[model samples]
Target chain A: MPYSETAREEQPRTPSLTIDALGKKCPIPIIWLAQRIGEVPLNAVVAVLADDPAAYTDVPAWCRLKSHPHVGTYELPEGGWSIHVRRNY
Target chain B: MLSAVEHSAVLHAAGVHERDGGAVSAVGVSRTGAVRVDAFAEAVAVPGTALACLQTANHEVGTLQPVAEVAAACREAGVPLLVDAAQTAGRLPLPEGWSVLTASAHKWGGPPGVGVLVVRKGTRFRSPLPEDEREGRRVPGFENVPAIVAAAAALRAGLAEEHEQERLSALVDRIRRTVPRVVPDVEVIGEDEDRAPHIVTFSCLYVAGEALLTELDKAGFAVSSGSSCTASTLRPSHVLEAMGVLTHGNIRVSLPRGASAADVDRFLEVLPGIVRRIRQEAGVSS
Candidate 1:
């Protein structure tokens, strides 16, 4: 088995997730956030951090399209943002 | 046009030392085709000085900088001016009051490695480094005689085509107007009233500049991004950063001489899909 597969199997299952998409531009942050959500168990909570100015629009749109429920969004003082998504499985 | 000896004599008469005081600073234009004056000012230490450095004759945004205004400023400050006419030297008449002008011959159909630097009478300049006995006191080293001859010939030929600039500028304007109509989520940069007439930049909302350039290259359109100078280090453009604009998925299109309307139309037709595909891959929507 690949090292990645072995590492995944050894890792403990968690209901909470974090996606650090800071410093990523545009669709990259949203796409990365979406992929991370896909890997979480049903009803899992995923938090995404993005620094792109467009993230205010992109993140919410992504949550809508992926059917993941948006928990909330908060603004970061350091010119970034945080979005919370709840995976619907 | 003075002969080689006359050119040397002119510099000598102007107190431009062949070895020491004949050097002029040069700066490279950004990928967006915009020239950054602050960088040049830093490099040459021209701040609050009488010395002026010229920007691209035609800016990357296709607008020409007010070289004459810069020259006037230098004059008011009692400083000489140097014009780096890389983008416009051979193609257009140089603005008045340019004391020293440098240009790459290849930009005007001449061979590479051949550069021309002209010093007007009474300009104070110095040679860059230690050197002796060469083409004038301004440039020291054995002359690439063949390249120089070719550059001169190319200059004359290019000057003959000055009339064509208006036509090409019009075509670029057309493309500038058409691109935004077709591509969504794009904000065209540098539409200032004083912008250049041959280059334009637009940033897609969700695409990365590198990915867009790669896709365009693969599709046979030679476009550029206003991002990093080299691959592997992905950073947004400093020009856009200065302007406080978004830098994602930026494309700078510089139309070469003789570029036709059909070519611009084709590029416009193909460009939106490229942006769309990249956005899709990145999972961004309009």
Candidate 2:
């Protein structure tokens, strides 16, 4: 209840799942991505939209620590980074 | 050294024990920002405890620590107590019963780079610096007399401005009362009863502290933020973390000496919209 939930209803064409972590801070974005990675099939991409400064480093670090392949990050129009990671586990 | 902000020097000093193969155990504060005396006792009771340090008040939240009670316990336990008065030197009366005391000049409207370290008589503190005759051989460098003079003058002037201090304190109270009401998802930190008058910290949800600071800076207002994201290291403030408050999107408003009520009003008028804009840009609806 402390974090604001703003799920993006738009469906991506790349068979990827988008998590609206736009307003969430550090650990929350990574936690959400980690917990919900199972929602997408194995090897599918999970994208996190986060504006928190810590996410710029933490997201990649989480992927590296968990041994997932980092798909790359794209700049979002709303002033945050859209980070993608493949569910290698 | 309960926090990394104002009392970083104390923390660094404690690190010396670890470097010498001794361990340093720190006791944290409760949600109200008050450290328990029993915890202090526990930390001191640890075998081979050399010294203990505590801040008189937290720089970020301005919550007063229960220092006197802890000091009494430390004395009975034969542990030297170092009191860091950085946030309380000029703002509040100095707490008694400290074996050693350290304070910064700039925190009390004095010249920067002038700091005070007092060792109570007969405390038997050995000087780490090489032997020198300056300042009774305690500090090795040449005394910065001019800065020390300016620092003393500033302290005198700040102490003499009691009337203006009261007026500005009222202005701070107004901001404390109005910010939460006008801005949603804000958690105002510190205890109202035992807080410094000039400082107020609050965290706004769904906003990046850096963006909010930039907006306020463009709007001709300058304030500090505790959000570690704004700092070079990108770590949250230890003070706010210890208080268990929101670490992101935190703002510290420290009213300058002789700050006027009109200035505070202008800041309050601009803050809500700036927070809203930042939240909106972050794609947060609330």
Candidate 3:
């Protein structure tokens, strides 16, 4: 099977959301998005962009507390980071 | 750390005069490694006659010794003042009218082993030892070229990130508020209005600093305890001692500009339990 077809067949179709919180420190990044994730459709993926070092530790911990699934984290060039979370009902 | 030349340039720019044959004084430094003061005070009996030296209260603690006042007193008494900017250099503004200033580069995010000392122009500073031909007859030995470049880069970077200081300050305030709410009887030191924004200190009533650090580390939190540095001796922090706060179970949390509020909050959430457990182990009540 092709890459897109394989991914589509493997995973459920969910809305994709991106939150740009670059340069925002700590709780603001997680807090802002956590508040907004409920507005997004259920089972949707929320991607958060942050530059703070503390976000790495905070985002995962926040996911644990809020019952969201922490999908993964990715590093960006030009000094930024991204955390992907899936909202569940 | 601002190097000797940079410090001297600042002094020269500020128009402070360094007197000849006077003691070298720095404000806000610990008694340990006070070679400049010791050298200046014992000049008459020792190898040379460089005069006055002074230091402020502990920098880690928010205790502001009367440095400027001491400088004024030294000026009236006819002595020179050298200030150590290790802990307070970037966070707090410098005290006015200091003839010489010194700092370490790594303390402010530059590379290590680079020390900065500034002497005012026309200040009579003679090298303690014989020197070759580097740093304009001031600092001897070959300088670490890359480290100096990195130090300048770090200084500029820190200055550019000045806006984040307020953010960190607010985060520190959150820690100050949240830590105590979570853990009762925990004394948070250096909450005075004059304290630096980047550092927060506290002591658990019934726990030891070492045990607290170990437990926190095991829980995946990196922090400094009074006993971390001097593990063998396990002596309490001199800063805490100077402030007359509880020294046994002290923890110093210094936040860099990159630390976030959520990280602080998570740490704060986990901290009370850690303290309680450590206290129980130490046979002290919460």
Candidate 4:
């Protein structure tokens, strides 16, 4: 168990932060993400949880415009999505 | 100057800038979102107050404004009052003393894409935009003649059905009464009487409004919600917020023309289970 734990800990993973934009409408999630992207360390992933449909496209588009890489999106079980964007800057 | 109960659209028209930190002196509203008359009187009485505008009735909760009183106040103050009657136009009679009245056709079952703007005679209004021939050069564009005809026809039909208004009002009453009783921890907004006939809004505790709305849609009923999660921006409704009501799991049931009693009954019947299931899913306690 110790060996397995050590091996698991050795594997590199992208650092991630969550911005709970759930229950917030469209531009809000984007705005919150924009405001807080600097809080995370460089190359870290920022996941914005939002339910607004506009954010599904807007977040990635914003990342593209801002020149950050959109990592991916994951659906939350309750509702909405956690849109992951990489802080390239 | 403006009323606290004014719609966002009106605020934009007035150029009451939200961005760049611009502000307008605004009148206040009662807990029920009714404009405070004394406060309105004060706001409009200020110097350089170009025009005073208000809605005949609020679109969200069906709360009717004191238009005649406000109109009288405006008249006494020599201020022009622009009444947005989009919600009240076909369903109710317009109160006298508005300098300008505006309405949308779609609100009254008319064709979408058609609107009416009436400037009372001797109002001394200048067109904000440059010259055009159509709409007396007030609105410059090629007229949508087909939509105009359809809108007029729909308005005529809507007005002819005065009895139908009362019927829909009764149906609305049923939902207003039944929703709170059926669903736990619900607050029905708007006055019991003295509200527009067709629209009823309510908020449910411990339920995510968008979830409830989606569940209802799956169950073959369509409704609107004011919950932040429900809106595209995920922002809670300004109307409900202004009314000082619960902002969560809010639902606005707008009974369309020709909707039956059974339809409302089905909605009331289905709503409780939907809320309960959602609460259970979200682990919200009773």
- Enumerate clash totals for all models, in the order shown: 15, 0, 28, 4
TM-score of each: 0.66, 0.77, 0.60, 0.74
Candidate number achieving the greatest DockQ relative to the actual structure: 1
Instruction: Give the per-residue lDDT of model 2 (tens digit) for A1-89.
Output: 10111122334336379899888776568667766888998889898899985666556645654667666766788798887778886
RMSD of 4: 13.5
lDDT of 4 by residue, B143-195 (tens): 89999999999999999886988999999888888887878767788777778
Candidate 4 backbone clash number: 4
lDDT of 3 by residue, B1-286 (tens): 1111112223333334334424332222222212222223333233332344433324444444445654565455455566766666665677875777777788678999887888987666766557778887777788899998998888778878867778887887888787878897666766444456777777665455667788888877777875334445533343443333445466778887699888898898888888877656644453
- The native-contact fractions of the candidates, in order shown, are 0.14, 0.02, 0.00, 0.00
Q: Sorted by DockQ, highest first, which candidate order results?
A: 1, 2, 4, 3
Ranking by TM-score: 2, 4, 1, 3
lDDT string for model 2 (B177-208, tens) is 99999998677878776877788888776566
DockQ of each: 0.09, 0.06, 0.01, 0.02
Cα lDDT computed for each candidate against the true fold: 0.62, 0.76, 0.60, 0.76
B158-247 per-residue lDDT for model 1 (tens digits): 678866677767876776687779887666766444455567777666677778888888878887776333234444444454333445
Docking class of 3: incorrect
In terms of docking quality, model 2 is: incorrect
Q: Look at candidate 1 and tell me the lDDT of residue B93.
A: 71
TM-score of the B chain in model 4? 0.94
Q: Candidate 2 clashing pairs?
A: none
